[model samples]
Target: MTRLVAVSGSLRRESANTTLLRAAIALAPSDIAVTLYEGVGDLPQFNPDIEHDAPPLVQAWRALLRDCDGIVVACPEYVHGVPGAFKNALDWVVGSTELAGKRVALINASGRAVHCHAALVEIITTMGWIVVDQASPVIPVAGKNYTQADMIGNPALAQPLLAALHAMAGVPAMAD
Candidate 1:
């Protein structure tokens, strides 16, 4: 089984990015398991001095990334850049090898969030993760208030997401 961890860059209670990941979990094929990582908000600030003695949450976060075959990130742009909290979570593992050689799929919840998307691609690549271009898709769910059900039920949204999942899983995309 291919295990994938999905992360939402936003901490909002009703984040469209989170909703998109939830929809991804629902739409994933039986062979691919997409687990949503919800502990980003709980991680402490990045401290290079204390990285070796990392706290429990940081340890857990790194372990999750290490164990997963790949990661799916759905993020919303904040002030023309990646959100602070999400960037902080990444900083925790920046100096570690936990994510080295891992595959990554970036899901853009808003097409307007190009800045964050580019920044994320650069960050993920610099961290030694392979960014799957085929899996990175712009779904444009921003300001739509879209629910998981709405995304799963709509072919326009669902098809692209499924194709992304397939790409991450190394499964050939089925002919429509």
Candidate 2:
């Protein structure tokens, strides 16, 4: 199975980015498995002093990133950049081989998240992740009334993410 870790940039439990990932999960192809990571907020602040004795949470987080075939992120823009917790979670793996050369699918889950998206792309690329070009489709979902149902039922919202997921799985995406 092609395992992918889907991370939401927003820390809220009912965030639009989270809904986008859930929708993607609902629309994923049979050969792909999407696992949502809910620990971004749970991760403690990043600090190098404790790298020698990494926390259990950090260990589990790194293990998942290392083992996954790909990473998908639905991020929101805060003050024209990434959220602290989301960036913190990513910071924990900067020098690790966990995400080296892993395929990445980036979805700008918010309407006003272009800057954040660009920043995220740069960060992921610098970390040795190959952000899949075809799968990095943008959909405006933040601060909207859209739900997981809208994401799954609406072709506009579902098709692009499905394409991204299929691309990550190295499979041809079907037309909706």
The number of the candidate with the highest TM-score is 1
Q: Which consecutive 10 residues in model 2 have the weakest lDDT in total?
A: 105-114
Model 2 Cα lDDT, one tens digit per residue, 1-176: 89999999888878998999999998887789999999999898999998757899999999999999999998888899989999999889987864689888988776667799889989999999888888888788877868899888888888888888989989888864
Backbone clashes counted, model 2? 1
RMSD of each predicted structure: 0.8, 1.2
User: Which residue pairs clash within candidate 1?
Assistant: none
lDDT of 1: 0.93
Q: Which pairs clash in model 2?
A: 135-164
Candidate 1 per-residue lDDT, tens place, 1-176, comes to 99999999999999999999999999988899999999999999899989999999999999999899999999999999999999999899888885689999999989899999999999989988899999999998889998899999998899999999999999877877
Q: Residue 33 in candidate 2 has what lDDT?
A: 95
Please list the residue runs of candidate 2 whose C-alpha ends up more than 4 Å from where it truly belongs after superposition.
none
Clashes per candidate, residues 3 or more apart or on different chains:
0, 1
Query: Lowest-lDDT window of 10 residues in candidate 1?
Result: 91-100
